[model samples]
Target: MIARAASALLVASWLVVGPTPAAQAAPATATCTSSVGPGIPPPAGLAAGVPGFHAQWYGQSGYPTLCPGERSTATVAYYNSGSRGWVNGRMGEVAYLGTWGPEPGQDQVTPLGGDGTNGSPATGWPRYNRIAIQPAPYVGPSQVAWFQFTIQAPVQAGSYRLYLRPLVEGATWLEDFGVFWLVTVLNADGTPPSPPAPPVLGTGYGFQNVATARGTFGVHLVKERLADVTVKTLTANTTECLNNCPAKPLAQYAAETNAYAGMNGTYLCPPDYAACAGKVNSYDYAVYNSTLRRWLNYNALNGQNGLLAFNGTTTSVYRRSFVYFQQQTPVTAAITNYPLLLQNGAVISSEAEQSASQLAKGTKGAIGVDGTYVYLVIATNANVTDLAYVMQALGARDGLNLDGGGTAAMWIGGSYKVGPGRLLPNAIVLTKP
Candidate 1:
């Protein structure tokens, strides 16, 4: 009786275990079939590769042409050809798009990632080398996953390529579908649709309403080569102006100096303001008259103000306190203004000590040099800080903020490109010798 009962128990155990392996193997076989259902189909042009954690390139959005320092959205689609499902936020199962190729390059850093010391082109990336991840929570076999990310073009204009490949992070990289994004970065123009022509040697006028990550600004400028022109400061008064100072329109200053281009000078007390009741049209900054070959307000040169000087052969921008330049450099023309904008290709202006007027958004003027050329700029609807970025965009190695607001003005090629906004006690002019 004990043997019969044991045999019956053994038979019952077989009944339970007999179908378990087939049931398990059935799903495993289906997992490798490469098809999800009747309506689901494998991606076109899909090639057989890795059995698990594999991906097939499906499609992507059109490549974009971006301006330097501009951001744009991009999307890439990948069909899961692997046996496993991509699980979001899972260490081993999560899939990511990583920088790849140029041969032997896998997970390489790219300028599009903005991970370098220069700064990011786009923000909110998973990692410096990781581009993006599957947007859905799970991407099963034969399903498509669309990964979206933002790309910020580098501040240089050129064709940029980012080779990309999918990988199951912490597991294995997927097939080398050999995909890449070819992005074109154009020259700086506010809404730049195409690459601008090469910068010419002579003066030219244009309005640059640029769009940046910070905001948009409208800047009018006169660009010229320092080698082709002489840069000088022309003051209406022969000496320093205290009160009831003589001021002239920008056109007159340009006419008298035979200047091809000109802009307003350093900050001053305008007659329109009640604060300038006694000091109407008065300014205390130091300026060198090229016509007279003497420095105006020479005593004020000891203060902490940015100095821009030209010695007929080269241009120089002194950050603050030009005592050394005054004593050593025999500059033909020099002018002093508060708050240097850029130094050595970097924005150095701080709004900490700025007055409310200086901090406000209005017309702002600046003078900048890129070692090869000089730029006289007038930015509308911008502040001191914004002017710094504008100068940087103009490729200025060093820049200085000049007087602006209603006093802002710029004359180029015998016409006012920006303003004749208000009369100026002094002006910076570009003349052909």
Candidate 2:
């Protein structure tokens, strides 16, 4: 009965209601970015490999900031290495996708919006004994399979994980190939996004609307006037870089640090290099957090400039000298990477490595300072050069290019001003003291 009910709801949700709301539409100038990447391995508890099944989770697609109790579709794809193909069986005796962990080793799930009883969650799948989504991929032995899931963030506000793994209904569980992401669901109730705390200085650092050349982009802006507001680099673990794995979802870092907003930080070591910075987990890029008072990692300039937080107060953009000269006074935060974008109000060439800039050309993330207001900008349909002009137009005294393309995104004002479509290496974030 629950399975039937879930199927009915799935049918209703699949039908086109009306025109895609403006909010649902990708920005006009947005570029195509694959939300799919190597799926991070299942949380520590998963076994090494499935004997008969081999599944590689590509990644998933969704806005980073999800509103509580809101229903949206997250698209995830995986490569199938099993002997049999996935099929939708009448009694659900075929291969299908199942949940990974509310705990490890549990290859079961209640359909979204359903209680634990009823039929298999995979029964909600639209096809019969098959798997695919629009712009379908060839799915079979060693081929790629894509699945679209309509998920709802729990009513409560927090970062939550909705894991997916493949299984053969009534037959046997497949290997523990996992695909999941940490979603930061904000509490807006039924109303517009609301800030967690009252605004500081009448306009605290959060999401603020900003007009751009193409359209209005909400920038995650931190007010220099507000005291106790801090900006830090966000990655998996706070204050340290981990080796050999991809960066965690932004929500994980934010929830851990209790940050108000998160945006992609500087580019990391070249993708082709075996080590990110000469070691798997150790960072090769230069970064420092003033509030944390730690030198996370350091490397020489790669023809790159930096965004620096000095004395735990002021922020500045400088050349390679900070590293060579060695400061007497304590420096709070220093981030160095890539080609400088804007220096002294003039646009410069991009320093992004070739690997990161190939296909994606959509909305990009950047940082610029205009007096006391430090801005995190997402330029719609712009490249690094275009981002520099954007900062100059915003009247920035100096600006630094952050990792853009798919790595681009901003979360503020209780919503994703510009949502990151991919998991990133690091981010610059704001927090309340």
Candidate 3:
């Protein structure tokens, strides 16, 4: 099931196209079989032994990025490869696309659709769990049907996936074609929403007191020419894991790599949260593991997150996209994070869509670069916006926000300066070559 699903996603990635306008509403009903034409090839790789009802994926519209409460049209095409004909509104014969995957069941209700009371992003779906049905009343074998639907992005800013499969209501599910859509939600200005608050700082951690124009911050900072230190991203696991993943403290990461300085890497699903039960400690950002010479969660490299990379002594900061970095080679270290705090020495973190925790005074962490020098900082009693000012005050040309709250931590010269806070799955480390 996993292999087939991956293959389907790979195919979809190649055929992505820009969003099209919402399709016109279909007439009450129509005969679609007559539209079948000659020279059309049969779909390849139909599931065997499921002659009664089967489907072959044809094509789908491009994935879209939307703001909260915004809506967009989406379409998917499929070829009927089964022996039976689909009849509209007929029990045991009507074909419909239902939510599936990321789980142990099918026909699950997705938050992207349904009545407003069901935590749906928007209303007007055929049903909470149903995405769409074939536009025509009957679809004969070898005929292709187009399914159109609307997707409303949720209020939260993050990437969301909706898995779908075709089935005849009250009958067996069709072939597992492994179809899904990836939607990204950001603020109206295209900035990431503020993250959740970090845990309160514990006493006795050593930090340099620095006062900036924005506010005072207790910081664990390092200023070194790139040539003097090799920066690398280290991970506890060699590969990705959804839950029960290996994680270790900042000191352990520093010791293992002989790193002189280190800090937490990215936002993650913490084990303590009830919502993280099935996927504890799983993070979705891309990070290149220097020791392994590979990217974990590599698929996320194509997203709109902020990326910081080091190619030997050359450091590059990407504010919104990783396409350019994707083509670069020989990168010694790399990590992606959200809501780029500073760009070109100017504050850029958005105040829009900031949660109460993000706006409230709390601990915040960030990594930044100025000229040939790099910096690691953990500020006290601050907000996301304050981090930008702090980075600017530190003379950073560009900066990116790291994981904060309980996940915030930093180590320097064989000991922790900010935290031995929470265990980390990944960390950015600096070591002498």
**Candidate 2 C-alpha error for residue 396, in Å:** 2.0
Output candidate 2 Cα RMSD.
Answer: 13.5
Off by over 4 Å in 2: 1-228, 234-242, 245-247, 269-283, 300-305, 321-329, 351-360, 413-416, 420-425
Clashing pairs in 1: 114-120, 190-209
Write candidate 3's Cα lDDT for 177-285 as tens digits.
3355666666655575564233232322334445577644545466666768888897787887888778889899899889878889988777654467788788878
lDDT of 2: 0.48
Better of 1 and 2 by TM-score: 1
Off by over 4 Å in 1: 1-203, 322-327
- Model 3 poorest 10 in a row by lDDT: 31-40
Q: Is 1 or 2 the stronger prediction by lDDT?
A: 1
lDDT of 1 by residue, 148-216 (tens): 666666677666767677889999877543355666665554233354444333457776555444444
Report the Cα lDDT for residue 391, model 1.
84
**Candidate 3 backbone collisions, by pair:** 198-405, 199-405, 199-406
- Cα RMSD to the true fold for all candidates: 24.0, 13.5, 18.1
Each model's TM-score?
Answer: 0.54, 0.46, 0.51
Q: Which run of 10 residues does model 1 get worst, by summed lDDT?
A: 1-10
Q: What is the Cα-based TM-score of model 2? A: 0.46
